[model samples]
Target: MPHCLYLKHLDIVPGDRANPCKGLMKPITIVYSSKKGYPLVHPCTKCGHLSRNKVAMDCTQED
Candidate 1:
């Protein structure tokens, strides 16, 4: 599994019609770990948007 600080572009919101920023992949920065031991958070490089990943398998860092 990749570390929390890996670089990734994930969907800001999976399925939210009200989300203004939709259908866009934003770069993520794993700021820190969560107490639940499953919550992963990061910010988008393009829009400074914050995103979370529950599953480590869903996290990816690419060059």
Candidate 2:
């Protein structure tokens, strides 16, 4: 029910485009990790495939 993004390709394995699930990745929650920082948890609406990805970092902005 949350906001989702319609990606042209799925990156479940990070750059792996062979995945057949072309579902919209819905952002469900924000997860915190000591090593990975605050990465977002996105699950596919169609296949329910989930992935954790780091937020885009701005070069001019401090992390």
Query: Which model scores highest in lDDT?
Result: 2
Q: Write the per-residue lDDT of candidate 2 for residues 1-63, one digit (tens) a residue.
A: 343333333664777876777777777788999999998887778887778777766433422
Best TM-score goes to which candidate?
Answer: 2
Q: TM-score for each prediction?
A: 0.36, 0.70
Which residue pairs overlap in candidate 1's backbone?
A: none
Q: After superposition, how far is residue 46 of candidate 2 from its true place, in Å?
A: 0.4
Which portions of model 2 show Cα errors greater than 4 Å? 1-9, 59-63
lDDT of candidate 1 over 31-62, digit per residue (tens): 44556455556565556667675555654555
* Model 2 poorest 10 in a row by lDDT: 1-10
- Global lDDT for candidate 1? 0.50
Local error of candidate 1 at residue 20 (angstroms): 10
Model 1 — TM-score against the truth? 0.36
Single out the weakest 10-residue window by summed lDDT for candidate 1: 21-30
